[model samples]
Target: MSTWKETLFGDPFAVEGDEIDETAQSEAELLAKGNVFEQPAATRGELWGYYLYYNGDNGFTMNSYMPNILQSLAYMGGFYYDGNTTAQNCNNMPEGAVCYVPWAGGSIPVASMLLYIQAIAFSIQFVLFTTFGSLGDYGRWNKWILLSATIIGCASQIIPMVWVNNDGSQWNGMMGMMCIALISYGASLVFYAAAFPLLADNLPVVRKARFDPNVSREDYVLVAEKWRNNVSAISTTFSNVGFLIVTAVLSGASFAPWEKYDFPDGVAHILGNAPIFNYIATVFCGGFWIINAIPYFLWVPAGRGGPQLPPGENHLTIGWKNIISSLREARKLRYLFMYIIAYFIFSDAVNTLNSMIGIIQGQITSFNGTQITILNLVSAVCSIIGCLAFLWIQRWFKIRTKTNLLIIIVLTAIVPIWGSIGIGSTKFGIHNTWELWVFYVWSGIFIAPIWAWQQTMLAELVPKGKENLFFGLFGVVNKASSWIGPVVIGAITQSTSNLWEGWPFVLGLFLIAIVIIFFIDVDKAKEDIRLYLLENSDEASVNGQEKSIHSVHDTDRPVSAKDEKFV
Candidate 1:
């Protein structure tokens, strides 16, 4: 009869006291042998694969829809020109609480309105993210939160069906509906806060390790360098994909005769229209989001040390105590704080640029809908390539964070110049539209890695066992900052752009962010991981001792006694 150990790890089994050996063993094996770090060494490719798919929809798919959604909403309110359709003018309603006509026949000052909305949305998301971020940490299942958000999102799209009229003006029904729709955005935060930490928890420690094991701890300092870069890329990609699709649709390409359908008045029309693709897309897209989330439940190990807070002592506590405790605990991790702050700054700029680009390209540029749509399609293809390439680069180069940051910085400096020129130019000497498309594609290569790096780094910044809390904070900052980027661009475009000057503010912000990126510390994070691993080695040695002692005892004891006991 084979021994249990023989059956598990295969053939000859020897437990080494080394830290690496301790991490290499599975949790079940560890339990059998009383080994700590019981969580198995997660395979490198497996961990990476899980996270890659998990996050694919997160920034790119969801956030990409932001500009388009807002645009649709504005369109329904009777805004015109800035890609406004006669179908969207909402100023002709009869007197009533619901019919305070907003933008009847002309553009509703989109840049200004968007700025205000984004600013408000930003603050709201921040509060929502902060409030619910710890749900996962406190041991709550996120599935319900996701489901609730999905339902709310679907319903929000339907509200427009009643308020929007054929003449492109809002009926009295819109005022009430807009309030509820904005409120619904909060539901998304609950889902994000829970999901981020869940992803972090899924990553194996080895996959999280960055620096060389030989490095010094004193030299290690946590910074947002690489993670920041990745977030920017991810956000940009999301913007790229959605904007590309919407722009393409508007680009004059005729929809398949059967592919088209009439949308009902109000919000439902915007949500379900040809360009917007209806609330069904929202439900399905959101459903897909939930589907991706399932693997985390199925495969990822639960957070160790149980919940971050004990029962009754959780966020439910009255008197602001929960809020204070959450803040205080979150503040303890200096690295995490730095990363979040960095995320706030750059994300604001990127998001704003995305919003501005959609509005400007759609309305301001003489480029027709077909041209805009074509450019966006090109952007999508480029983004996909860039995303895949970045992953390959990470694996092939075995590059350190500092090195990666340096590369990103170089690309950041160079690509924006090209992108800015493409956006700013009146003529490319050759239909200029194709030139913009080429630029969009080329720039995506540099932008695709931002989220991947940021997310992976954030996972590292989190305490080994408390990934939930760290990622909760991540979601808080990430969503909160989301509104800033778009608002800034909107405000600037509103104030600056005249017939003569173009929207240079977008390029200016990108440049400023690049300057900020230079100051971030990537090397320090790598060194920290190396030092932490070394310090924890001693605790790992007991596995070797237990195995050695047990083997010796077995050899010294009589074989006949062991056999008799077995019998």
Candidate 2:
């Protein structure tokens, strides 16, 4: 066994016993000529930094806190909740409230404004994900790309501290900041997720299994799968831990349980101290994130970078080109695409379900900051617990990645199924305030691990050298359909004046995704990927040639009957 000092990074995958033909192997097998692929165990610090980096990005900016703030602003901007009269949650907006708002115009509900913002942010990120997403693979750009986005995202959160208006007079500016923050956060996540395969690929046990020809490809993949699960779960736990720590301290300090001493005359109104304190809590989360993240960039070796780009290609052009190649490979790479399709649908449903729940949750808590923070605190603790619990359960069951996913998918449906009960009656489902408590605990424990398992599964499916491009596409699929659920839910709530109306649609989506995923052949997918590498190892070079991709796509290999469904 290699010691911690051993450089376990980016050593190319080589078969020791097989008499392999040089002609059959792409020179571009996982690493480029003379690229440094060696990093020691200290890289855990790097992973830790990257995971903790999400605190401000996801924990603060994209969490329920932002929605609560936005909805609060909306109420101030003239959207109120009246039990007797409200618009499709909107159509009945009180005469005193502003029924029509800007950006899309017409009689849009005030509460739904944030949903449209969610959609538009994803719309922008779709462009970013497709454009710059592949750039990280060609050089040591992944580190810098993540850092740059992290700064922008954190700034977008902290910058808002300067503007605090109880009347929501700064609503437009706040909306702009939210879009910027969400887009930046989404991009950072894509780049961050793209690193998982690299880390898993480089683990000592995996590296040994990878190079040992006696270890069957299936056996090697098993090693890789275990490490992938470990890395994803630990990293996710670290993220939620960061969320736990920062949210707890900040919210506590902001609320100030002790009786307040009045500020000296005129200072009370300066920077609108109360709102500023809350906003500063958000800023504190960002600062803590940057502090934890700084060490990773300063050290930690980068793993395999794919083949060098062709002379004329730049970061912007390479991603779009690679993505096009990936789409063309859809027929041949059947199981991967099947998973992607299932992911596309279920993720859409889940994202929408989350948004609907957040809307109702805010109503249950009356959009109170302390209440929201407490829920977040509870969620953070449960999220960490969930990730750890998942790893324990997986180890105990000795399950495959697909089996783990099936479990998560089935359990995740419970959220929407229960929420849908509200469609028929207000007495049960997500109607009561207590359900919000249950929602936080339930989702934190079940749904949070879905991300860990899903990412682990994708790491299993993606071709070795093309992790960045495939992960980028993973992000594109996520962003591409994310807006659908939010937009549809917004319209549903607008038409019905009831938020519960959208749960059934989300439940149906969950059912469809579950069915599709259940039928997917994970074993077939693994075998296909194994064969794919042998056939197209040469084409995997990062030279950015369109013809090479076309050739890969046009392989003379024939597809069999059962595999035809994958195609």
Q: Whose lDDT is greatest here?
A: 2
lDDT of 2 by residue, 1-567 (tens): 544333333233332443333233233431221112443332555555545554333445355556666665665565444565553223244443333344455556654676788888878888887787766555667777888988887787777766655566666677888788777777677666655556555545555554454555456555565556555545654665566776677566645643343544544333223434546566776677678767666655655344456689887877778778777766578878888888899888778777777777766655555666777778767766887898999999898888888888788888888987887787888878788888888777788778767777877877665554565566668778889888888788777756677788888888888888788787888798878876675565555542222111111111010100000
Per-residue lDDT over 267-325 for candidate 1, one digit per residue giving the tens place of the 0 to 100 score: 23222235433223333444444544455345534432113464465554421354455
Clashing pairs in model 2, backbone N/Cα/C closer than 3 A: 86-92, 87-90, 87-91, 87-92, 88-91, 88-494, 88-497, 89-497
lDDT of 2: 0.64
* Cα-based lDDT at residue 131, candidate 1: 58
Cα-based lDDT for every prediction: 0.42, 0.64
Highest-scoring model, TM-score: 2
Query: Model 1 off-target regions past 4 Å?
Result: 1-108, 139-141, 158-165, 171-254, 258-312, 316-340, 364-380, 409-436, 459-467, 497-567
Ten-residue stretch with the least lDDT total in model 1 = 558-567
